[model samples]
Target chain A: MTDVRVIEIKKSVFADNNEDAARLRSELKGRGTYLLNLMSSPGSGKTTTLIQLINRIKDKIKVAVMEADIDSDVDAIKIKDATGIESIQLHTGGMCHLDAEMTRQGLDNVSLDGTDLVILENVGNLVCPAEFDTGAVRNAMILSVPEGHDKPLKYPLMFSVCDLVIVNKIDVMPYFDFDLDKCSEYVHMRNPKARIIPICAKTGEGVDAVADWLLEEVYNWKH
Target chain B: MHELGIVFYIIRDVKQAAQENGVEHVNAVVMNIGEVSTIVPEYLTDCWRWAADKEEMLKGCELKINIIPAVTTCGDCGREYETVKYGKTCPHCNSANTWLLKGNEVEIKEIEV
Candidate 1:
């Protein structure tokens, strides 16, 4: 006599990354630090935002930054120069995104015991980062005015996947042909709950709101 | 593409599943890709072509992708609606008050091995 069996199977290709992100998430939460993954294009003012963020939030919060780039540690150096905070450059080599395993390694090198805010700056890419979860408590995206308001429509995944959206370069609105209302409409279309904060990272116009949000997240996470 | 790495993972999991099921070979892989997941189907297929050829059991297994539309429900009215392309706000009402109902998942639901 012979028997035939049917097997039920469910598998995930991102299992490895998921496990890494899960462990990393617990590690951050266990140590009482709010992790934010900041992602944007190459010239989308993420670094500038970091510089301004460091200037405002460093005194109020104990912060550490994990800067990811393709090759250079220039951004990390810039962050260090702006403030005396601990900054580590987490390079992804040639990879377009930062996965949970990479973020785990980055976190492993940092001390988040008394840290309040830890920001992981992902490589400057739109697509891949949206797909890979880095176990951040909040995934924030920076969209500059020059990148155009149509961005939310073009790269729906990047904008829709974010928890917070920083419409950077608002100060440039006067000089550039940017439509704030249209951009907001598109952003809300993709993610209705996404908090849209417009700012001019160049002139520090709306840095306070961002700092306030960061403080709130850290406060809520820690206390 | 991130799909290349994902393909490797799929191959590994399918191999284990086949071994446990006592199946000597895999015939097809059916996947449900989320619309807002930042995965390009073409790129994923291209990666699968190379990755699957590396495995003896999955050498010629057909790859099928079903794109799941990005959809959400309004928190205020509980009205489910299909996402209007890239813009996430509900079409019925211009309210930013929304929550993702489905369409951001990446999973390997079935494997014929």
Candidate 2:
């Protein structure tokens, strides 16, 4: 005798996560808060830049953070110290990239009822983070002066998907021979529509421009 | 190293496909991989051996990757060619104005049950 058992499993690898991200996107939009998913390699000054940005825009914009870290809460602590704004650290444990599910889980822990912005500091990796969108309306790519200018080509996906390119750590441009023009050219080549902003996260250079851009993005979104 | 993640996705997808087709076990899975995607096929298969070995639905499943040409289309010349040579500049026109046409694909194509 032959027996037949029929089981139905409808799933995409990231379907559940993507659904969660979609819901978060809607929730953030409803709360009148803009979301930015920040991505970069380790030591690319994403955190430092965030601190600098908070110094300038904290009073003007209500900001929150969803920090993705593999192990430590050091970055979350630093962001809180810099801005005094409440941030929820989403610890990935072993995950290299923060998927939509984790970000939504982090959102559940945040009080976004009256926030103006939520910046998700993605795990320090240039590749996978681009593939998995966390439902953030915008993604910012930070390429530090020390990481060289050829990053856009090698990590094209990350740069191509980014709405903004932050050339961080530009204060030390005198010491390192980083080709600002070449970096922007590459960024433009990959994505002609992307905005490239150069800033020094540590020295507070060109931060207001970034804040201005954020204001513009937020204003544009609301209308 | 991230190939492990891709493999898990593959295993998960194949199991679903197999179940939907009412198949007891999946025999093989075929994927269309772009040359420029960060995923390494060899590493993906290597990770698959361990992750899918114990699953009854995925045991002995074969993984196949279809290579997609890494073509970049020049804005000026309007020509496309395989520029898998690593650099972004177009080899034909020597123009950095080209955009990627393919080679960044990462998708499952087919599965045999």
Best by TM-score: 2
Report chain B TM per candidate.
0.89, 0.90
Output the worst ten-in-a-row residue range by lDDT, candidate 2 chain A.
A4-13
Residues A25-116 of candidate 2: C-alpha lDDT, one tens digit per residue: 88778778888899999999888888888777878778898899888889999889878998878888777787777787887888887788
Error in Å for residue A167 of model 1: 1.6
Candidate 1 — what's its lDDT? 0.83
Q: Evaluate all candidate structures by whole-model CA lDDT and list the values in order.
A: 0.83, 0.81
- lDDT score for candidate 2 against the true structure: 0.81
Deviation (Å) of A23 in candidate 1: 3.8
lDDT of 2 at A182: 90
For model 2, residues B1-113, the per-residue Cα lDDT tens digits are 46776676777777767766768887677778888878888888888888888898888877777878788788878888776873567777788787788877777777765
Best by lDDT: 1
Per residue, candidate 1 scores C-alpha lDDT tens digits across A1-223 of 4353434565556776778788888878888988999999889999899889888988888999999997989989999888888999987777788888888889888887788888999999888898788999999999998889899888877887898899998887877889989998898877778988999898999888989988888898877
| Lowest-sum lDDT 10-residue window in model 1 chain B | B83-92
Q: In model 2, what are the clashing residue pairs, if there are any?
A: none
The DockQ figures for the candidates are: 0.45, 0.24
